[model samples]
Target: MLKKIDRAAAFIQKESELFRCPMCHQQLTAKEKSLVCSNGHRFDLSKKGTPYFLKHQVQTDYNQAMFQHRRKLIMNGMYQPLIDVLTPYCEGERILDVGCGEGSFLSQLATSAQLKPSVGFDISKEGIYLASDYGENLFWCVADLTNLPFQMGSFTRVLNIFSPSNYQEFKRVLVPGGKVIKVVPGSEYLKELRQAFYPEDETKQHYSNEAVIDKFQETFTKITRKTLKYTFDIPENCRLSLLEMSPLEWGVSPENKAQVQKNPLKQITIDLEILIGEFL
Candidate 1:
């Protein structure tokens, strides 16, 4: 009763072209209250408020805690500037978000613009599952990027922010005239944390430079580059979640954690370099 209606609503909301099957990369047609593919594959939308794009199984390295912190930080506007730089490329057409953790950026893009349709894919099931609350217009999938489960030339714009990029797969799925927006850390990203954790006065801690990104740009047109930086005060309540979301998780010693807990950071730097390129 209620389950059927929820599925129906989800199906109708995903009426756009983003709900293609992850395995077959076929546009799904909602038939008899279930989503079906041309080759006879089918997946029923879950009443738990998520669309089951993968029927079988997919493994992921992410856990609920990682996304939980990321969600809060993003929603708090930690990465707003990066999203602003990438939004212009959308222009009301198809867009694909690779490794879209918790779908915060995608959700903001959908609400802020008159977007045509957008789909978000991640290797993390928990990430996608948590993303369902954003909107029905946004299609969420749990899948891998090394071998993207999408058809060729499916998207007009692709966005990869602070995530692993599969260049070959990204170029394959994007339309010939499409563009890609990638965000990486600037030379000063998280300098404060690194200083506190490592205390290595000899080693210069910094971010990726143009030379480091040269291999990435060989296949695309280098459009523009911009650096963004801001200071954020870490509240005592959310400090633990913030620590878990960082690479410092492994590098931090038990003693270091104790230090952080005792003298929690008042402010930290969020520095990033945004690169916008056109597919060649």
Candidate 2:
């Protein structure tokens, strides 16, 4: 197998235009183990094959083990529907997955689009490190959503899945007719998980994407919206994974946790809306 750095460097070299110095906003050149810009700003590449593009370290609740379980659930095809719906909307040779955790969604979408030199970045170092496992054809990095480390008008398709949105930065990095495909949770998204944990909390039992969609509409004059709702049966093996994978787990009571562990949920909701629009 190729060393991690070996695989990542190859793609970085091929898709250098997707990157710029986050600190200096200058053109970046790929090197053996680092990226250097014309203005002398350098970002060291992790030995794991991903680059550190954040101006400073960021502390996030998303941990390595959580990402591992998340990837486990994802690999089991929990998010395949989202990927299927995203395929036809994807355009251009390259794509960017914003806030990509463990890189599973981007990896799957890249395959669907036959995208070359796909890029995925998140503020979580642990997430980015784990994402390096998919680095053979895709480049991964540690970056912020508010200040992406890429050149303006470099990408034709940008993906923001169940993650924060920074429309200003999104527009800066996308081509004139580029698209931003964002996925936000629907009211029933993960209802079972919520009922199991916070049974009486009405707020926890549901969600609303109105404000998020409203903001998206405010940014783009025109857009397409579609809701894909389904329930995924939890394989016996993935029951524990389901418990550990969600941020929802953070608020569960210890008693509730044990109860769910004793009687694993049969299925969980995957209701989400996909919002697609142009850079304008």
Candidate 3:
């Protein structure tokens, strides 16, 4: 495991010149088991083969159980259509996934795009640990999105899939002419689940992408939007996994959850808008 981590570290050090200290913004030098900056900010590689890049600890509701179910769903081809839409933009040699949960999407994208030196990071330590354990030939790290520990213009492609956007940070890390592929949920995405949880709430039945789309356009010069809408049949046994993977059920009552579990939808809709953009 240590040897594999060393290889991942070496790959990061060699492929991009953008890795920098989160604190001092100095260039990071990779050692056998850690990365160090000129000002002496050091981040150690964990036993799971992921690096620690966050300055402080973060608490998140995205726990291991959620990620595990998410991985299972993803592996079962739940997001293959989205992956097909995302593969083209991942043309460059280096790719970075911001807010990558468990690294499943990034790993699949890397394989589909035939990319090298793909890296992903999240604020959740458990997610990163799982990512490192399950993903192959990818660099995983626990890092903050706003304070990314990479040098300016270091990546050729940046992926933001169902994750929050930090436009300034994204633009800073992407090379000139590089692309950002962002996926945002559209109306009807998981509508069945939403409806199941909040049957009487009219607002819960619909979703809007106006604000997020407008913001993406405001940030990027050239933008293209593609909406992939489809319905997927949910396997009987995987229904619980599907329910557990979503944040929508986080605050629902146990009775409501049980209600959905007992009468699971046979098919669910996947409505997602993929935005491809380049810096102005």
Q: Top model by lDDT, which number?
A: 2
Instruction: Report lDDT per candidate.
Output: 0.71, 0.86, 0.83
Error of 1 at 133 (Å): 1.4
lDDT of 3 by residue, 143-220 (tens): 888899988888888888889999999989988998898899998899988989888778877879889989998989
Better of 1 and 2 by lDDT: 2
1-280: candidate 2 lDDT, tens digit per residue: 8888888877777778778888878899987677899888888777888888777778999999999999999999888988888888873357888999999998887778788667899999998898888854788889888878899988888899989988889899988888888899998988888899998788888778899998898787569999999999887888888999979999889999999999988799999988988845
* Candidate 1 C-alpha lDDT tens digits along 110-224: 8666676677878777888787766645666666777665667878888888788887888888888788878787777778777777666426455456764675568678577
Cα RMSD for candidates in order: 3.3, 1.3, 1.7
Ranking by lDDT: 2, 3, 1
lDDT of 3 at 6: 62
